[model samples]
Target: MSEANECLFCKIIAGEIPSNTVYEDDSTIAFSDIHPKAKVHVLIVPKKHYANVAELAEQDSHELSHMVGIAKSIADKEFHGAYRLIFNTGEDAGQSVFHVHAHVLTGEVMAE
Candidate 1:
């Protein structure tokens, strides 16, 4: 596991910060978004701290696959056909938190 001093997701995983968790496992967690953009908005993040997808290249391949698999399950079980998976990487892309995460959204299309 990565060092915890500067990671928000790590804190969320350890229950240091409050969150609405939807799914959990040894390596990951899926939770509802506090500032939801849709009827079914969720965030899926790895247990380890990585700043973004690019930083996640060092992690094992299995974790990536499992994250995507979780995303699909969330979509199928929650969205039922109308949803989008978004990963904003930098300031220009709207990423506020400095951690790797997948945003699963549905119910309405977001504005451009």
Candidate 2:
């Protein structure tokens, strides 16, 4: 996937599209999910885009760690120590956006 040309999350990170930003650093940006699956649902994406975890792992695994750290930090503050970090790698896995992201799902209760 050409992230700059087509990825929605890339646009969100670039400020090409607005997002409810929660956390940001040089490497990543964390924001509230527009269609939240949980009370504290958020998505953490890297400024440098990769199509998915495998692509990211092959290209630059450090970016993956950066994204995970951001997710953990967000969960720490928002979930008060409980959350799930999810990565849907492909369409079959429910990854609608090709750009890699970590979905932080939290709150008192979440759907299964």
Candidate 3:
């Protein structure tokens, strides 16, 4: 199978894997994170596969921005529009899944 086919997020996008979907559109999907770091933690992912945030930005900056917009919307509804966005770019940076995604964390005071 191709790398995209083997991707976890790809499977989720394809409905092969179940996910707690929050928002979805033609280019992106937002879902609740299974292992959440914050009270309201969601993942904003592109339907199209990219290795990481940098890769996604290089390939489709518009989609990257859309992901951010979705993250903001989620924060608006879940945490009074106050939130933190995280992009873990590589394995060394704590990104386990190769598929590019943005983590939207909110609902409490963020640790420094």
Best by TM-score: 3
Q: How close is candidate 2 to the true structure, as a TM-score?
A: 0.89
Tens digit of lDDT per residue, candidate 2, span 25-76? 8888889999998889999888887888899889988888887777777778
Which segments of candidate 1 are over 4 A away from where they belong?
Answer: 1-3, 107-112
Clashing pairs in 3: none
TM-score of each: 0.85, 0.89, 0.97
Name the 10 consecutive residues with the lowest summed lDDT in model 1. 1-10
**lDDT by residue for model 1 over 22-112, one digit each (tens)?**
9999999999998888888999998987888777756666787788889888878866756688888997889988888989886665566
lDDT string, candidate 3, 16-95, tens digits: 99999999999999999999999999999999999999998898999998988898899899889999999998899999
| Clashing residue pairs for model 2 | none
Question: What is the model-wide C-alpha lDDT for candidate 3?
Answer: 0.93
Rate residue 36 of model 3 by lDDT.
Answer: 98
Best by lDDT: 3
> If candidate 3 were superposed on the true structure by all CA atoms, what would the RMSD be?
0.7
How does each model score on lDDT? 0.83, 0.84, 0.93
